[model samples]
Target: MTLAHRPGGHSAARRRALLGRATLTWPGLAYITAFMAVPVLLVLGFSFLTRGRFGGVVAPFTLDNFARAVEPVYLRIYAVSLLIAAATTALALLIGYPTAYAISRLPARWRTVALICIVLPFWTSFLIRTYAWILLLNSEGPVNRTLLEIGLIGAPLRLLYTPGAVIVGLLYAYLPLVVLPVYAALDRLDPLLREAAMNLGASRARTFWDITLPLTIPGALIGAIFVFVPSLGNFVVPELLGGGKTVMIGNLIRDQFLEARDWPFGAVLALMMIAVLLGAFAGQAAIARRINGTARA
Candidate 1:
């Protein structure tokens, strides 16, 4: 007679609750296990194992791959990759923060369109986009032609196939990544906080520093991670845009896997990439926690 005992109603409700939780978590867990965690484990295993003839892993385990990765030649490439990634992150932040701020201040009617424009490039194939830069920056390309026509120089500037060009390509490809999170953060910020600061006799700059900036740091950090991690491991941009002259860790990994036919070494490089990405994510999480703690206090 009681609802709890009527026709398995309570059992059905419990089953539904369990099913709801399973439905919510099953897709994400499956994805992580299949694509992220398993692949990462495979790489880690290969890093510690010996490479067999022609790129397969051998039965023996060894640390030689990791040891070899730290040799001067490879270390130099890693250092350069880190430098370029850092530079790209910095440039993306500088360019994206202002754009995000302007976008955040736009009327609501225009904001969605602005965001679409920011993210629209992501819809295109990344390789195709990089190749487009190839056409634009080539010696006989439109950019060079315009510069020559304007009498800026006697010849086309060597705009492609340099480290600077690689950085430029990276910044172009990743700027939207930095902008989107920043816009999300800034849009969530309360404008009245700025007004409150002003009411307390704070200057616009001071209000920004003390209120707006802190509130948006999380978003900026998110954007920086988005730019930094991928830029660190990018091979296509440096290959196509840099014309195979600029070699980063991603290129190194590719060479090991394909050209050198050394799976163990490639696995080591892959592990290092994962480590760097994880470190970035951990750093971001720490900063976010600190920010939230400060807000709570």
Candidate 2:
């Protein structure tokens, strides 16, 4: 008998397929709903609430917290955070692109080794790695000692506890993130394209610029976004390297909740960060679509 003419048999098969699909997807859906969606909703709801005199959130709703976020002091923090994040992303790109290119050109066996070296830092605790930087950049650290011995400086230059130090920390942390994506893009690239460009009388540099670089822009953008987003809200790097002098949005949010005892204000700041991140993600998506469209054309 045909499946349609088999009465309840068709219905039973359809139900089984539906059940199997639900079984595969439901766990992931539930996890996201419980963790990501719920927390985001809680933060959004809290942002409109009043802060209690002691610590917790209060009942009556208000916009005062958001208003306070726009005040000069907080705005200055936001500006500094943006500057730091931008600098970090730029530096990571500058350093990572060449490294990734070189790695991609290596023999297949060595390519794995190079990539492992790039990612090795991630195996350790991030906090521990930051502490390692403190040891390396401190006044009496090896960097300063080497410079002094070489007569490059009369004394230990103040490398640690500065905005520059914060940038260094960020670059150290996120450079690998930029390298991996760029390498993936470069490695996936067809070598025949470059050969064809050279056959057409294009110089090596010209081929790279016209043929390879344009194609890899999306990957570079992905890496830049990856580095920039985390660096914006990074409290640990600024706190450890910038030494409280460099207060970013992340630090400000922490202080609002813990020190100032203003949960609502903290929620507002957190929500603002989320808004900025969402805007970045949207921009990335649009740019990716344009790049893909260009590729298809």
Candidate 1: clashing pairs of residues:
none
User: Mind giving the per-residue lDDT tens digits that candidate 1 earns over 55-115?
Assistant: 6789788989989999999889989999999999999999999999999889998999999
lDDT of 2 at 115: 99
Question: For each candidate, what is the lDDT?
Answer: 0.90, 0.89
* Candidate 2: C-alpha RMSD after superposition: 2.1
Taking all chains together, each candidate's TM-score versus the true structure is 0.93, 0.93
**Candidate 2: residue pairs that collide:** none
Candidate 1 regions exceeding 4 Å error are 1-8, 19-28
lDDT value for model 2? 0.89
Prediction-by-prediction clash tally: 0, 0
Off by over 4 Å in 2: 1-10
lDDT of 2 by residue, 229-263 (tens): 88988899999999989999889888887798887
**Lowest-scoring 10 consecutive residues by lDDT in candidate 2?**
1-10
